[model samples]
Target: MFKAYRFVFIAIIACFALTQCTSVPKRTQTPQERPDVQQQTLDLEDAKSSADWLEEAWQAPNDIAKNSALVQAALTLQDEKEWQKSAAILARLDKNQLTNDANRYFRLAKGRWYAHNQQWPQVYKTLEGLPEQFTQKEYKRLTLELLAFAAGERHQYWQALAWQVEAQRYSDEPSPNALWQTASQVTQSQLPAERPRDLVLAGWWRLIDNHHQAMTSPSAFSALLDNWQNSFPNHPARERVNSWVSSDSQSNEVDKSTNTIIAVLLPLSGQYEAQGLAVRDGIIAKVSETKSYELVFIDTHQLSFEEQQSKLEELKPAGVIGPLLKGSVTEWVRQTSLNTPQVFLNQIDADTSEATANSHSIFFALNPETEAEQASEFMSSASSRTKRPLVLAANTPGSQRMVERYKESWSGINEPSVSLFSQRDDMKSAVEASLGLVGSKERIRAVKIAAGKIIVDEQERSRRDISGIYLPGNLQQVRLLKPFIDVSISPFAERIPVYGTSSAHELTNQLGDNDLNGLIFSETPWLVQNGGQNVLLNQWLDARSGWELSQARLAAMGYDSVDLLQRLPIMQRMPGTHWKGLSGVLSVENQVVNRQLQWAAFKNGSITVLEEQPNAGKNNR
Candidate 1:
């Protein structure tokens, strides 16, 4: 009986040992057995929950030193499109230790991030770095898909189509087919009816059609029109499409004929009649001789807003211009729906939102912002020649606007030392202060006595050191500031330069034969001796009967404006090309005009053109 009890006790001990060895926790597995144990645990946990598997794997002790847990987590985040997090995880993997699968997955995640950011260049960079062995059909498929998307974003429609076509070799997906269809719509003249929903495609089609009409490419345009008609046989937009095609065809033919109506809308008998007539003359002179266009003039004189509207409605002109008074412009814009392009001859009260809104359909002849930019470039060049600049103006609206523009223009270049002087009772003191002589006791004493003559003379002597002066006041006001000018010019009149605007023409009359002898500035054509003789100038002059004076710059502006419409397709690309006229050299791009003003120095009681600067195209001009 004792022997039998011993055998049973031995068997029980064996059973306990077997249970402990077989059911041991994965964490406690022997070093050699750890991988197997962990694998078993991973299988069981994966069967239950991937989330639980990740949690347990992350919690595994250092004995389980593989990066499997981190990699799995990364894959999870990447599957959810959480690209940044996935990239962070894959970055931690030692490249030499990375398996083929891990490398492929890592590249896939990075490519996706780049594609999301529309970084086409970076996408290509990443794809190029993948291992040669990773070039599986799946990788090619994904690469092509992303390549197509990036190409489209970059406006490379042809490349986009090629990529989509290549992608089709690997995947039978409808998305790639749709992308190809859309690309074709953009790059090809003909398009299928069942194209994918793409707003860009529609915009491209419209742009191409408009361009074809503008360039008089009838064959290309007709083919596109026919294709569109056939594609949308029963489409609701058929009427609008037909109308555009027909109108464009007729307009193109008419544009070539002498019967082309060029309408002029100016204030013939209003307060600003003189200025209006100048602009009118400028337009008529150009077209009257050119058989290509017929000139039509409409005077907005003694007409109420409603009457102006009625007249415009009755006279369906091909194009219109002017109505110089700000109030008159507001009324005309409100009443006229001629669908004709109109040009505003002068600056309007920008405070009027309605007039500005009208600019969408009509072109503004001069944009203050554009003017300021040009002025800045001009000032920058001038500033380089003269290190010191003085801005002189009154507290009037025109003066204030000019001052602001001057400041903006000067800000872009090496800023010149600036001093502002007011045209008030304290003008003398302000002038001295601007010259940096007011605070000096000796300088003050010199100008304080002898009818303030000594100081004026001394200040004038010191003022000659200044490089240039920007005078924003009218000629009358400028003459009033002559004493101040004398302070700067008395000693160095030939060396010290003065600059003024079109207003300076009035001041020019006030100056002695040599008073403004060294001054250089801009003026309207009417203010100058050679007011009206260029072929371009005659166009504007002939528009109106009277020789009402205009800013000399107007002639150049008119030519640039008309020339832009004539060369719209290449406008953006033709920046540096010079458009010479009475005003000066003009640089135009994308319908934006930048004037390269010729430097005219006052010499021997007359203005002489000095140097002609190169127009910097769209840059500085």
Candidate 2:
């Protein structure tokens, strides 16, 4: 009779059910179930307090009252949230002293204690394969409820739903809201192969959410229910839907904005104005390709940070994106109070990665660290026979950043990587040092000095321990650095494969890139897909050149940002889905956007995309 109201109290646990239970096991009895002991428990109508029960257990060893009073004390402890003490009270009791019913009570209580402490796996293990008779009839309903809650936490949503439904029929412990939440998690955690079952569950949740309509107007709800039943006639939820027994108040009131209005926080007039404008153009270009969304552009230079913030509040958009610099992104995340989902154009450092976790935001930085890590994984998988690698980098800030990240990526190798910063004062010497050639030559000179004579061994050569090279720099630098590496290691090692990031070269200038022959690297679709020849993309690229990140590539980045916003819901709803955009094959997880890049190489002086490692596209991360 109280099932309908039971869910309203799920958040407020009921201690009375626990404290008042004196249930005995149903199927069997033992020495403890003797008539005298049963009568002793019932006779204690004005029983001593839980403390007095504890005293009775120790003072009256074999007394029948001792066994009965101890059970009461455990219940009293459980009611007070002294879960460990409650379980301990049962554990210390003698197995021989417990009747079959008493044993059942102790096991069920211990299992419930684990659930209360969120030790879900322990709860499952404790309750697994227990006979139906093990749980007293009066306690079975709550046991089933605890089992269901634990199942949901472990992602066994199907089993969780089944257990919860059975529990609700016995006693609606987890209300419709809690049950519906379990259903939604099941949907998100489901496999793509399970889409049919997922949809059926989704339909059931829809019916549950419309419970008010089902009750207020039976005919209308019946029609909807009938349509639902027709779609999934064999669905387990059919009976629940047909019953029309649910509360509309149980449905979630989470924000469901379509995100029609977007407030952009990019610099349109200042130092970063060019890049910001390029991104804005890309955002604008996507307007015709998909759903209509209003873009409100606020130039960072024209408006003060506070003024920009004030304008954001004034517009009250469904989403916010930008503040490209790391510092701006940091401040905005710290102070922003808006509840809508916001995408920052930069990544927060380790400290900020944790801080933004609670905010309605995600990091979408163009971080090379992720790229470097993936590159390491790719190269490591590509070959182990080619000798350990050499890392040659320029002295500029960007080059150093890439080299540092590369060092982090390759930190696991037993054969140490030779990393050297080129002063550009002498590229040849730098490459030789990176290959250990300089060290080898210096050793030979030291040996000569020690002997006080000059003796050259004809077979002696520079150290040949390396197999490949990783150089991250501009196209000009790569063109200049590759040959030095090739010649420096010629005597001792064969010219190994040279790898680079996409930023190292412009594949569009095929004529000038003849010098980049044999270079292997990863590329976004924008660079690999015929120079992103789509007419709409070209138009935006033409107008936005020389803007912040004036390169057409940055313009492509701008375009992807907008397209990603529009498809956010689809990606979230079906997490396994991928959007093959200009940037890469994009996917979203834990709020961060991920890209699966393609491999390419300069073949015969013209770029050729590699089909050698088909499985390499998926990120190991």
Candidate 3:
């Protein structure tokens, strides 16, 4: 489990140890300015609250004592759950005054603060190097745990499992369950194809991977555990596997039903009928791959709200997935008695506090904002040295949402320059204005006007301040926007990076996508798998030549919805666990399922999946 840093204990050790260190140079403070060292050491023992430590820092004899006191004050604030207050104190501390050990404590405190705020990149930057640096086992253990949690949060499951394996050496008891949880989340593709160098980690990974296949068949899990223990008799996990099997058996005995009925509601014959069918088709596709389920589909458009309620009462399904329309979903959830582990296709307008509190239902929507936030996260961690960004969006609700989300998630100091175009005709003009092309043209015109007959050899120049451009538009819009951006960049300026949403990419002929070359975008793994060499997806596309990418995405949503139905309970119980779904890497927070999508870029007029970059923003900071 992830726990807050017990800085109070470490802070006290760091405080007293500060006076004995001779590694750092002594501060050149006047003799009159310094407090009595013997008195200050005695006063430090009585310091308890943040204010008491701050008072001690103010009265400290020199820079070393002062920094130690300040560091303790910050740690004290963090231990009290006042992270922001602690951050303010940490910001002002002079690390130069502290010994190597004291500086390690300072870095740990800052990393803990960043972890509390869910700032993963900052956490990675602050603590990625401190694991081996710590002399104390407790501090090193916490650092490894933080790194593991951060890696898992970012969907770096293989890295997370490695951290878990390392953390085990410091713990008194083995955390086989925790290691298994992180291991199970690692997709087959993500796991190293060959055995890893670490035999312990490799053995555990192989065991858990086999365990996944065994879980499908009744009584197979126990047999698999026995076989694994026999094979890796001296493995670290061998000791913990027995208890795990016993715990699983006791739980399985209480609830062993496999034939649970699930109710699905979609619009079969209305304005949104096509969208509803795509989702249903996706569900059927997944069901076809797995065990046969009694999937009862209800067309919300055809049935009245009260009739839908009466039907649910009579059927009493184990779970429900649907009511695709926003209005229908909102009305459906208002009925308190109809609660049965539900997954609404559209988000409810009314507050879902009551429904999600008890883990009865979750709202899953394929919103443009979610993809935009993912784009923002990807760009933030991208290897680009872009400090300033320019966001060019269409003047639509979805486009606006993208812009808003990009700005909200952005980590840089400079605010993104956002420009919106309402019409297709304005796309070129909007891109030009945002890039300062219009201003460049005006400047040349003014120079010509000023010098009547003189020949001006000056070329138009775009702004140099924009390090990157984020454009979240549809295929056609992106096609036009990319070309506009390509041509608009000043000859004098460096090639600025451009990022877009999944909507920006669609199944199009390579010749038609020449303009999108070098443009990076966020997309679902299902559509962009195997460098767009998705055999089944291509076959489906060839079979249905007229299907739009939006329909395909809805189908993906349907497929992942079926997955969510199976995994939501586990996610609800264990908040930070992730499932690699067809749509994206899914994790639940506040009963809302969020997707961390895969990334791709256009190169030589073809889509290519981008490799996941580790420590992406290490140098950027």
Q: Looking at candidate 1, what is the lDDT of residue 247?
A: 66
Off-target runs (Cα >4 Å) in candidate 3 are 1-45, 48-258, 383-386, 445-454, 506-512, 530-535, 538-546, 612-621
Model 2 worst lDDT window (10 residues): 33-42
Residues 134-169, model 2: lDDT tens digits = 334335655666677667666676577656666665
- Minimum summed lDDT over a 10-residue window in model 1 is located at 33-42
Candidate 2 lands at a TM-score of 0.56
Q: List the residue pairs that clash in candidate 3.
A: none
Clashes of each: 31, 4, 0
Question: Candidate 1 lDDT, tens digit per residue, 369-457?
Answer: 44434545465554543244676667666666777777765633334444445446756666667665545547556457745533253
* Candidate 2 residue pairs in clash (backbone atoms < 3 Å): 274-547, 274-548, 275-547, 275-548
Local distance difference test scores for all models: 0.50, 0.59, 0.73
Error of 3 at 12 (Å): 23
Better of 1 and 2 by TM-score: 2
In model 1, how many backbone clashes occur?
31
C-alpha root-mean-square deviation, candidate 3:
10.5
Model 3: per-residue Cα lDDT over 103-154, one tens digit each:
8879888878766656666777888878999766666777888788778766
